[model samples]
Target: MAEFDDILARAADGGRIEAEDALRLYTDAPFHALAEAANAARERVIGDDIVTYIIDRNINYTNVCTTACKFCAFYRAPKHDEGWTHDNAEVLRRCGEAVDLGATQVMLQGGHHPEFGVEYYEELFSAVKEQYPDLVIHSIGPSEIDHMSRVSGVEVDEAIKRIKAAGLDSIAGAGAEMLPERPRKAIAPLKEPGGRWLEIMEAAHVQGLESTATMMMGTGETNAERIEHLRMIRDVQDRTGGFRSFIPWTYQPENNHLKGRTQATALEYLRLLAVARLFFHNVTHLQSSWLTVGKAAGQLSMHLGVDDLGSIMLEENVISSAGARNQSKLGELIDLIRSGDRVPAQRNTVYERMSVHWTPEDDPSDDRVRSHFSTIVADLQQKA
Candidate 1:
């Protein structure tokens, strides 16, 4: 029987591990065996289907953030002219547009606005649900919960319960850049500590809310720090089984306070993706960010163990604000997945298959195009 270390040792030898083993695999194991084992693990979990993506849109409700993290380029302070908030009607318009364009989910993310208390989200979420009951309100993160609690004078658990009761379907892991305190403070000094992030996530999980986990790489953190981030999430996952997926994205280094000096490389991203697959044994879904890394990297990601290609974001602003730029058309995304020898499936927030395209031969024609566009931008000019 193969022990865990033996499996890791074999993976290291085969050039399949890096990042740290990525750091060590180049020197440690027989590269072939390491690659074989990692590949086998990927195959065993994801199988040969080559997982695809969802046609969803990210509707950033507001840019007004109170936490002035050093590494952020998206948040706008209260007095900053760029700071703005989306009202319920505007948020619903975005949801309506997403639903019109066949988007199954709307990733509603924003900063920790000091004044936009729990009532704001409760109203916004309830309105969205009232109008677009079918649209998955996969919005908010732990940071928002923390802020809402502080603003409303409620506890974290209470805030989560109210938001969930209003309409939030699931939480998205946004504020988790690096779980280590040293790196976290260096990058996002105003945000909650690493333990608090996990605690809030665990509370959300216990309250019947499922969420995803994320890591922002290349912020000058050590490779060991990256592994520690994974271990932290893995530990919580071991306890509650609440995290649905683990997404590892490279930090964009353009307009943010943290400049282009130390962005995670493509090879580094792939190594982390592969290592994430190996380390997070209990996490089921591993998503790749085509929006941050280019489509080529996203395609290569499948070979490295990413089962989901994330969303075909009709609109994305945060990373774009930071100077990361990549977009994929619906047709092109399907083609890319097939090109990698995988079936393309559109999934909702919970990974349920809403639609699946087996071959290019079954592609939708011109008549189907209008409806798709309608779902994403029917009321783009509407204000929030």
Candidate 2:
């Protein structure tokens, strides 16, 4: 407990805690006590107020994937009957709906379908942007870039340039599970290497696109490896400062090739959250994953130094496809942040505030109501 307190003290002072201390925090620290200490550290940094979330939608445009990763349950093989591909019109429709409902950003993620090369994304993104000029297109990750490059016969840098030129505003940190080669291969052998993930991210950053850095935990990686993942992102961030946020989500074990045998505990997630706050001192924002850990754990995560509650995803299929059980309402989210003694604000893809929601009444009504209102307006217009 003394050691735990010492780590907490260091974090509160904005001092770096070593990897060994981080391991102890993950393995041995008592739950509520650790939460309290982490919250104390968080208060020192971001203060007791000002927790934030984004009004966005996660649009999975396709599920046809070539890389059959053992840990993923969201992707379907190319020939599988369950696989789906959303046409440009369908994708645009989703974006239009999101915009109509007041979503400021759309996370456009999909699998690495062999046929959907750079041209496919260019057309899809261009269409969405052409329709909704104000909507932020935060889409794709490094693995998709690598796969698209290989499939389209283009260099990684060139692929990034074309995608950004089309409409992609930022890279979603989806593909990075663990940065070390050994564990990453064990979990996702078919995906790109850790070095290549960083290299492409650097390439994209150089081409004037910033991205989020992420970690997928509880896939049997050692504590040292997890710290190393943080270090890798930290080193790159030191060089480029291109990463806007650091997000770590636990691996959900259900309906996947890796069954429900292994998962990160709630305590483990918080420990990592706290450590990430202390370690990645250069990274300005740290986001909590309510989608994977459930809303309660996500609320506790803010105390563990997460300033952002991630997206209030109006539509999500990836993590839900993996068996994550929690769904949050916008009102509930505001309450969660307020219960944590923080003000809740809605942000855009770039962390720009769209509005600060002070109470549950401040939340906009549900999308279904807005859709009904729109239908009424159209009918009245036709009658006139």
Candidate 3:
């Protein structure tokens, strides 16, 4: 107990812990003690008075993918009858809906289509920006850049430059399931290597395009591997300092190849969140994943060093294709934050607070701000 306390005290005193120490804290530390320490660490970095949530929509443009990852239930094989890509009109219409519903950002993520290359994205993003100039286009990740670069016969840096020129405001942390080699290969063998992923992200940052880093836990990854994931991200952040946030969400085990081998319990997820807060001394923001884990666990995350509760996800298809059906409305979400004794603020894509709710009366009652299932999921339900 004394040793653990000393470690926590050192972390509180601004000392960074090593990977082994982090693993110990993740595996051995008591739950309440870890949460307390992490909460303190969070308060030291970003004050604990307010918790933020984003009003954004995830518009999956297409599901036609080539890399058949074992853990993914979101993608369809190339030329599969079930596969579909949204036309430019459809994409713009979705963006229009987002704007009408008071969304400040739209995360446009999809599969790596064979025909879609850098030009495709350039045209699409340019069209979106030409129409909805105010909507922040937070779309794609390193793997998508790699795919587009390979397909369009250009370099990753060139691809990022083109997309940014075409009006992509930021990159979402989409393809980083697990950063270590073992788990990454086991789950997603065809994707770029973990090191290559980091290299591409560094290139993006150097080119002045900042992005978030994400890790999908509970995908049969060991505790050591999880710590290694954090270590790798920390190393990158130490150099470039471009990562806006570090988001760790759970891997939903359903309708995919890696069937129910193992899943992270709520306790395990919370422990890792606490350890992540202590370990990631360089990263700025840590987000909670209510989309995969449940509302209760997400609320508990506020007390365990999470300052952001992620997006209300006006429309999500990836995780919902897996078995996570959790959804929230604007008022309900605000109430969730208030129930945790924290102020709820509506934030934009760049983490800027658009509005702050100081009391219950201050909360907005816009029903259009709730989550919506994707058309694919809606179709599946209708068939069932």
Tens digits of per-residue lDDT, candidate 1, 1-384, equal 233366474442332333455345323434344445556667777666857577667787888888887777788898798677777778778777777777788888887877888998998888888998888888788988888999999999899999999999999998898989999999888899999999999999999999999999888998778888987898899899999999989888877777877888887777777777776677778998877888999887777778899887767777776776676677787778889878888777888776777767765433332212422222322433
Candidate 3 per-residue C-alpha lDDT over 167-219 given as tens digits, one digit per residue, 9 for 90 to 100: 99988888988989999999999999999999999999999888999999987
Score residue 339 of candidate 1 by CA lDDT: 90
lDDT value for model 3: 0.89
Q: Model 3 compared with the native: what TM-score?
A: 0.98
List the candidates ranked by lDDT, beginning with the highest: 3, 2, 1
TM-score of 1: 0.89
Superposed Cα deviation of residue 251, candidate 1 (Å): 0.9
Candidate 1, residue 365: CA error in Å? 5.3
The lDDT leader among the candidates is 3
| Whole-model lDDT values for every prediction | 0.77, 0.81, 0.89
Error of 2 at 259 (Å): 0.8
**Which segments of candidate 2 are over 4 A away from where they belong?**
1-7, 16-21, 28-37, 359-363, 367-384
On the 0 to 100 scale, the lDDT of residue 232 in model 2 is: 86
Local lDDT at 224 for model 3? 97
Once superposed on the true structure, which residue ranges of model 1 sit more than 4 Å away at CA? 1-5, 9-35, 365-384
